[model samples]
Target: MESKAICLGFLPPRLGFSSPHLLSRSPGSSTFATRQKFDSRQTLLWNKPQLSRGRVVCSSSNSESKPETNHSSKSNYARAELFRGKSGSVSFNGLTHQLVEESKLVSAPFQEEKGSFLWVLAPVVLISSLILPQFFLSGAIEASFKNDTVAEIVTSFCFETVFYAGLAIFLSVTDRVQRPYLDFSSKRWGLITGLRGYLTSAFLTMGLKVVVPVFAVYMTWPALGIDALIAVLPFLVGCAVQRVFEARLERRGSSCWPIVPIVFEVYRLYQVTRAATFVQRLMFMMKDAATTAEITERGVALVGLVVTLQFLAVMCLWSFITFLMRLFPSRPVEMTSPLSELLNLDLSDTKKIIAEYIWIGGSGMDIRSKARTLPGPVSDPTKLPKWNYDGSSTDQAAGDDSEVILYPQAIFKDPFRKGNNILVMCDAYTPAGDPIPTNNRNKAVKIFDHPNVKAEEPWFGIEQEYTLLKKDVKWPLGWPLGGFPGPQGPYYCAVGADKAFGRDIVDAHYKACLYSGLSIGGANGEVMPGQWEFQISPTVGIGAGDQLWVARYILERITEICGVIVSFDPKPIQGDWNGAAAHTNFSTKSMRKDGGLDLIKEAIKKLEVKHKQHIAAYGEGNERRLTGKHETADINTFSWGVANRGASVRVGRDTEKEGKGYFEDRRPSSNMDPYLVTSMIAETTIL
Candidate 1:
């Protein structure tokens, strides 16, 4: 931001450190951008320098540590007049200008070529990348394992693993903004420059460099190699993604397909696991080697060195690749310069933050959120400032007078933005400071605050089940359109891809909920294919509502990214398929005490009398799902029995036998409002 040009004075190399230094900085389109070749002319300016950390340390007898910016009065006059109000430092300007030109040449403007002659080489490259390393490493692995089958499997797995891991590394570069090479990348609708040369180089060299341990493992022991390989499997499965993805990008030049973006999600997941994989692989290998006990001192040293080297190698590779990107981006990566990263840096420095205020829409089933910057970090809800939104936009008010106030009730870590940022759970009120009609949390709050309700200390664990449907057709994810699968007999907690559909979305949602600080217990495939369930645990008071709503919101975000639809319609399909349920697990302080089975029994009696009233508030369209058949109690009746899924309220056999523990309320449908459901349970049983 300085206005004047700075004079360049040379510095002599420092003692002890004589290697050439790298001065990395972003330089393109922000000003005097250049696209001229970096061939040989500018290389002279960077021929000499010393490196330390950020500062360039130079040795001096009399002197020589001066930077290239101090000026003489005579030169200062010329610099001030000639390059005024523009960047003119020798290294920053010279390096960026040349790098930009080189990047353009390397990542040439893509041309859409269907079945282009270049693809014939892709297969050849892919095969060679996978086969050649295994072919060379096989002899060593064959000696260690002695079994030809295990040797071949281990050897080939190593090559493939390295290749897949490298895919993730390649993407890390492409997804970031580099200085001279790329400033901003405009995405093509369908066409893409898939991996370019890095696809081949990454497989051949990076696999050899960072994943060098793959070869060293064979000499140590048998299972050590396999387990170490397994540790990197997160990267393997997460990034093996790109092999198919790159092929598709090449094959479908300029053509659009929805699945590409979904598969690209692997990159995000892979990044999260990248740092952890090394540690996991180390533990696995150490455990395996120590058990075998055929280890020599040399093997011990080698194993330690290998793991350490590999860990350092991966870290260095990341730093080198990222630094290399900003400098000589010979290959243009299609990165959307996230301007937020600049602001994010400021956020980290200042500790000021973004708070995403989330509220339920007028439809009650819908969740809404908006973000605002706050002055600084805040923990207490009372300390956070109140904000407003246009109520008419969310159907909570008429346009004539539409502002709705958002009162912060709870705050959770913002999983998406991360750092010190937070996700605030809020409820709406009118400008006149009255709770809006759709503010169920407010009513739940009043009930929870009651002295009797507070004394009971209610806990609710809601099992929320929902079906995933194809975005376009609105049919269950794996079910045929206008048709059905054989039956739901084997789909309950099914393992195979055929029976368990949308596991990725489900898993993503589960992790997102946990990362957002929600009390998410666990998740599993449901009895119905394309359906899954996640539990919002043992949370107390109105927090049960707060967590479930946020968890649901997280699922909505993840499903949206996956281009899938989440159906909370109680029963998405007619007939024999099992319906989704919110299945509230309730317990009071008394119910968890010794000899509390009698107390639980008394609470069930209260629940049975108010079954109809609770059902109406449980969810919309409950009659469609609560039909006596399909693991559901009939809507018109209230029944209670031990371990009875079909009963309106089921007491666990353990609870009956141990004379303590929680009872399950089997009536609420998947679409039930947790605020209403949890509070009502307390109101009837304890209050």
Candidate 2:
């Protein structure tokens, strides 16, 4: 895990991923001074608007000492409508709107292809595993081992091995392209990851298969009898009634219907028992005619095979079915860390605590922090005093006057430290109290604090997408060190080992974000194997910026502890891959009311006029990522459409149908500053 997912201070977009033959260096541990220089320098700080080659050019001179808000430009656009004409100011009343189809809305929940039922494949795998051990070795095992420990050992080994093999074959999809887990034709790392993840699960099931039967026989022998089994059959009739109720409950995020499947399973078990018993009875009748007991042993073995098939079926059926259900959306699978043991230790005895002061570094994207001792628990951020840091080391000031002041603005629970110890989100300023150039939050605050903006109560939902890379090779986790994965097809929101990677880290960060009290809405596997996304949403004004940045800090901390790099690169890979983005979903108070759809469209019109400005703040190297292909609009154009991933702004179909709801700005890149992106969207749409 020595790998780091470098986003802020990483090299300019590496060349290798875009093409097969293109060569590039993996900056695993390099001091990446190659971060996009223009990100920090070529900001949206235009001096004045000018015409350039039949287009408007609004840019600042390179020699400017301090940044200024584009007051006049913003003022003009604030009073403008969607469009203007010779007669009067115009609107989008007659425009043909782009709408997303209902069919397209249900994308790959497990990142599988359209109409491809992956759960069916898992059941097939379990069936095959059952057959190979029972039928393939039935005669030899019965003769050699006499149904003893040797036989059990042989059967279990074969079952587990074949189960792993079957899973490897069935789960072979990552980044939309199909390649079996064992497909070493391109990358041997496939075999490595398969053994590490799937094989572990295989062995786990092997133990469960052994333990479940023993436990059932010992603890519930009477429950396995005919009377108990028969009672379950009548309850199965209530399935329709249960479904009617469960569907209603589904809206409230509850489901009793999952138990209906369990009932069906019990009925299946009873049927399997009857079929096996009938076969054993037939064998006994035939064996009675012979003097030898050999036929009876074979009869018993045949019954065992049938019973084993049921057992294997149940094991595979439940696992894959649960996987499919979980793919629908569940709480992030928080990994149990030994570090959590420390969080549980009694701390009621002490009143002293630690408070970590965190702030944006000179790079703006990089986070820097230092801890201070506190007398006791404190909830208010204003009560926390400001601190100083060596600004020159972080590229924020000259060596002579290297100190930068930290103004504590927000506070979150300390997930790592536990107890009343906290993490303070701070912004940088000079000793004289003037904001530093890299203090993006200060600019965001000003916009959010505007009286017009405050009245609107702009709300934002930011979808932050990112890729996880191996620190050593500087390649995506689960990706081949120097080669490519199967082309993108089924990886969006995909589940299973072959389809998803780095889920443990993703889940860990999710929990940590929640523990730290950020408004993290959700998390999911993305359109690439090692890629992922989490959402910070329904947050109003400056709190949106505060929460998103803190959530990111939590993710970075989690990844650092796990020893993997979490990349925020918009396009970590190149070529046919899906690039990462932080799709900004936004709405003002007016946009959520009736006829809000028109207000949304009007906002888009303003966004269109200032598209270039927004793009500049989106993220560095976004031009390499936002090509017109691969579910992205061309970076140079601005377009709004309903439920379109390729549009600059996407109005979901539900929003159009209801004539109210938020619109998503899909143009923001994975590495875009949330403070800048969220605030700018509010400024344009409201102020």
Candidate 3:
């Protein structure tokens, strides 16, 4: 193969090199002294101007010097050699200097044309030569010629002809247009510079497509097909053309382009040779180890080249294609809605938005409050909407009703004929040892073995552990437990009820069974908290579960029989900097309105059924009532006891206040024995 290496040529500046229409020249007159004066004056004038605006200030104040020819025109001569000199400029005094330093003082605008022509043309030639042959041989050229050799010859001729023709036209146009601009004497060099850049680009491209690919293929082949050729051929040609241009540019004393192809060729050749050697060795290795087929040097080289070239081509093309796609407007699609379009932003942008949202802790309280406060489809009470009678409405109501009617110490089934459906709520309850301790151990047994305490150990062992363990494992990143403090553990209570009773109740039994308390780590699990649909189920109430029910029931039965004791409000529990909840943390008022333990709901039902006027619902929340004064006094006493006597006190200021509103205490009107109070106090041991 003929080595396409061509000489780096330097064309002397087109004649009339010192003319204004070409490279600018300093005008001169006939008189030598006048020329000297003019040169000195010109230098002084230019030297005074500020260089900040990119103007070169020529200092020429001291002018009683040597030859008169050493004027402005002569100065131009000295500097001109930097750009025009083919052998690179040197000082008249003979100091060799690179052209780049000269260019810094003589500023040149950004020019793409110098290398663009080659960049474009080289790629075209190589691409056509390598890939066009495939199409012609496979189908087109075969149809044109019966002889295989003729077809090959014709295919090569046609592609080469087209490539050369394109190259010639592009080069001719660029060369003609670019000269007029680089010749700065006319102040039109800007145009030439731009044209030169464009020309350079075109030539560079063509070179990459043609020269590089051809070189690679000749050196390594069999993998030179349409896809590989189209992909890698351009870059290869570009490399080759760049090499040729840079070599030529260096000869012309221009340092704008660098020699890159030599390095590329050397690297590629090394890879190909290494691959071949590896393959020969691999064959022997595989034979001894175990092999399906023999390995060949050619095959290995081809594979290595394909893998390397394929990767480079794909990466470059993919990056360019993506950039192009981003630059262009996206195509309009039949989108469902604006919201969908907003949600479906570019993947990177979407990720950024998500990161920002998480960092800011959701859309902020303003947005949340707006969303919470926004009234949905509000219906007039009198003008009952169709949904008011719909079965779905009943389904929705069925979920919540179970907690109110069945759970938390409500009416039970007839124990004689039908198994009494026991509902219990244990206070600070646990299975074995009391998690929340008391002074007298007897009180724990009394609470646990109470008459209405239904199934023994119902509010047993730690229930929160099961839920918490499952929660922590399921969402490792999201719900971690290491944040809480040991001093103040949040007491989570489960509300549970049983109903082996009438038809209406039994029908609701299926709904109640949904809270199976299955482990939540996997598929079989309780629905997560804050899910309104599941929590409000008829069988499952607010804070509903087996242990919670037993705890609450124990507290309630204790209150009814032994009188008011203590009260808790869990919701307003504020954590300190160390993350421990404050004492007297439980508050129903601060509980999440979404689905929290509704003490009023429990108190109302119990009092209403008991028909006791001492404890009446009167909060105006649908006329809900309670033994308000007595309950308050009991809670105050419990607080005082916790502070002073430590929860063991039975009566007095550290206990319940005997007043009119004290619902559990005997009324002044109703006479009661002192021994009765003492006996009830003695029964605390049963707990």
Which lDDT tens digits does candidate 3 get at residues 386-414? 11111122121233331111111222221
Ranking of all predicted structures according to lDDT, beginning with the best and ending with the worst: 1, 2, 3
Give per-residue CA lDDT, model 2, range 1-687, as digits (tens): 211111211111111132221111121221221112122232222111110011111112232333323333211100111111011110111110111121111111122322143445545754575466657775676587864435544544454456445533333211112111101111111222233564566457546655544443343333233322222222232233334433433332221223333433443443345435544544555664765565555444445445554674577466445434433443222233435677677665777889999888766678788999888998999999889999999899999999999999999999988889899999999999999998889999999999999998999889988877654324577653223567776778888877898888898889988899998999999887789999996899899888888888888887776656778877776556788888989999999999999999999999999999999999887897789888899999898899898888899999999999999999988878889999889888887
lDDT of each: 0.62, 0.61, 0.25
Clashes in candidate 1: how many? Answer: 2
Off by over 4 Å in 3: 1-143, 147-157, 168-242, 253-309, 315-687
| Model 3 worst lDDT window (10 residues) | 355-364
Residue 274 Cα positional deviation in candidate 2, in Å, after optimal superposition? 49
Cand. 1 TM to true fold:
0.54
- Which of candidates 2 and 3 reaches a greater lDDT? 2
Residue 119, candidate 1: Cα error in Å is 20
Given candidate 1, what's the lDDT at residue 222? 57
